[model samples]
Target: MFAAIIAAGVCSCYYDSEEGLYPSISSTCDTTNVTYSGKVVPIFANNCLSCHSNARAASSGGSVALENFADVSAQAASISAAINQTGPLSPMPKNGSKLKACLITTFDIWVRNGKPNN
Candidate 1:
């Protein structure tokens, strides 16, 4: 019975934080080229577009469209807070693992750089 219980516990899926999975990601992350078109967009494309895209926002992403420069720039402050899982904003990638530290840092830098459209 103990063996069976242990097996079940070990096999069950649990939420994995980035720190638990890839501690090295923070040190190696390249935060120097965080452009709206290049770095920021790709992050949203991978992690957010399914819900936050213009076409799907109404149905799934609370109408928060991040597919364009104006919308994203407008929401940049909240985006930073949400990704860091802090402030009044809800932690993002909602119901999923936290974003890697590097990605969070990159996004924060973009937001701090005046959220430029470039």
Candidate 2:
């Protein structure tokens, strides 16, 4: 019985905010090049879409279909605002962790750089 319980617990999924952020931030993303092809799409794939993508039957928020680059390009500002919004009901990934500081910095740089397509 104890072995079965331990097996069940080990197989269950959990989100680790730090694991998702700092290493991915440094390795895969460059703030200087925050384009749809790079920074934003990957972040959405790894974090947001598990809950927000249309592929999930339980997805919320109007089929935000973030499975591709074009979707992200068109929705950049809205995405940015949602990520940065502060209040009782801001719509982010809804993790216990606040969006990582480096992640926010990268988004700001991306916006400042004309929201490029690179």
Candidate 3:
């Protein structure tokens, strides 16, 4: 009985991987190679498209369409401010949670990179 109890406790007491317990450590944000098509569009697609797509911009995105590169580049300043929740304007993803730190970094980097078509 003592041996069984010891074995059970030992088996159950293993440490969880860092990635599982604290994602930030292992899930470092990839900031080295952010690109407009490779990184920016996908973020918008996942987080902003429901309201910010071209088709719904007038009614849902407050006329802020992000479905294409030109539109996003035109709105770059506003996008940066909104995503960081820094300006007097309401934060973007409107009522949603702030984007992940990595995602924000990625967008900011892309903007700094001139919102390139690449």
Candidate 4:
């Protein structure tokens, strides 16, 4: 019984690492050449489009349309603020989890590059 208890204690002492739990969460994020269509759009599609899409914008996105380049460009600064969960703006994605660090970095790079349409 004592040996069984020792084994149980050892087994229970397993460490949980963020990277180990989230294998898909990459450590190295390449932010080079970030673009509106290629990088930005896909990020929006995955995290923001459900509510901020053209169709859903009116009813669920608080009328904030992120479905296209023009709309996104207009709100680029605020979008960046929201994604970073900083400044006075509310954190984006409402009840959803914050975007991955790599994704946020990519968005920041895109915005810094003058928010190109490409």
Candidate 5:
């Protein structure tokens, strides 16, 4: 009876789906209408601006400026690589955690969409 009870208890443990375990990992990331001002800038503001903004670029950002649209646009590929923590470039947020996959996907979509300022 004791052995049966223990086996039943062990078997009763619930298994969580990946999505349930990580609710933030969305299966469908809406990348349509991604724009520099609306999407890209906010991502930079939240993550890169601290070190890569114009004011701080020369000091802590290794001279990389991500505050303005022009600079951001020019370095879009590098930025993507860095944030995605891929390729030869250093992973961004530099010493911090990588950006969420959705955010990276959004950036890639923005880049693909000709990198509009809107």
Candidate 6:
């Protein structure tokens, strides 16, 4: 899936394997203590805002605003479901792999940890 996302040109490479790279996204929290403020916001800011936020007038799912922690936290259940979408439906940001596996892992952890504010 990661390969396909990259191949489809949905996300750009922030660092190369040859560069002994840094993670594509940055967050204050790690896998052990994921939280909305520290871990999840950065992912959405970099990946999802192109379409999901007010900055873009062409995006869907406008019923919810994803600009900040408070807005996102209010939509916690929706965030969880999107992150874990199945079948034909893709997760948030529609199609983008800029977010590394570690980032997604942190999101999973945040959901598992009850979507804390941090």
| Cα RMSD, each candidate | 10.6, 13.9, 11.4, 10.5, 9.9, 11.1
Question: lDDT per prediction?
Answer: 0.82, 0.64, 0.83, 0.83, 0.83, 0.62
Query: Model 2: per-residue lDDT, tens digit, 1-118?
Result: 9999997775563234434334446645445556666776666776678766767625564567666666666776777777776544456776546577567657656765676777
Please give, for residues 32-90, the per-residue lDDT of candidate 6 as tens digits: 55667766888887777767675562456454568767767777677656765643445
Which tens-of-lDDT digit does each residue in 1-118 have in candidate 4?
9999998876665335434333454667766678788889999999999999999999999999999889999998999899989889989878999988888878877876788889
Error of 1 at 113 (Å): 1.4
State the lDDT of candidate 5 residue by residue for 4-118, as single tens digits.
Answer: 9998775565334333333565768655578778878889999989999899999999999999999999999999899988789999999999898888878877887788888
Using Cα atoms with residue i matched to residue i, what is each candidate's TM-score against the true structure? 0.75, 0.57, 0.75, 0.75, 0.75, 0.54
The Cα error of candidate 4 at residue 2, in Å, is 57
Clashes of each: 0, 0, 0, 0, 0, 0
- Regions of model 2 farther than 4 Å from truth: 1-30, 87-89
Badly placed stretches (over 4 Å) of model 3 are: 1-27
Instruction: Candidate 5: give the clashing pairs.
Output: none
In candidate 1, what are the lDDT values of residues 1-89, reduced to their tens digit? 99999987755633254343334566668777789898999989999989999999999999899899898888888888888897888
Candidate 3 lDDT for residue 112:
71
Deviating ranges (above 4 Å) for candidate 4: 1-27
Residue 74 accuracy (lDDT) in model 6: 74
Residue pair clashes in candidate 3: none
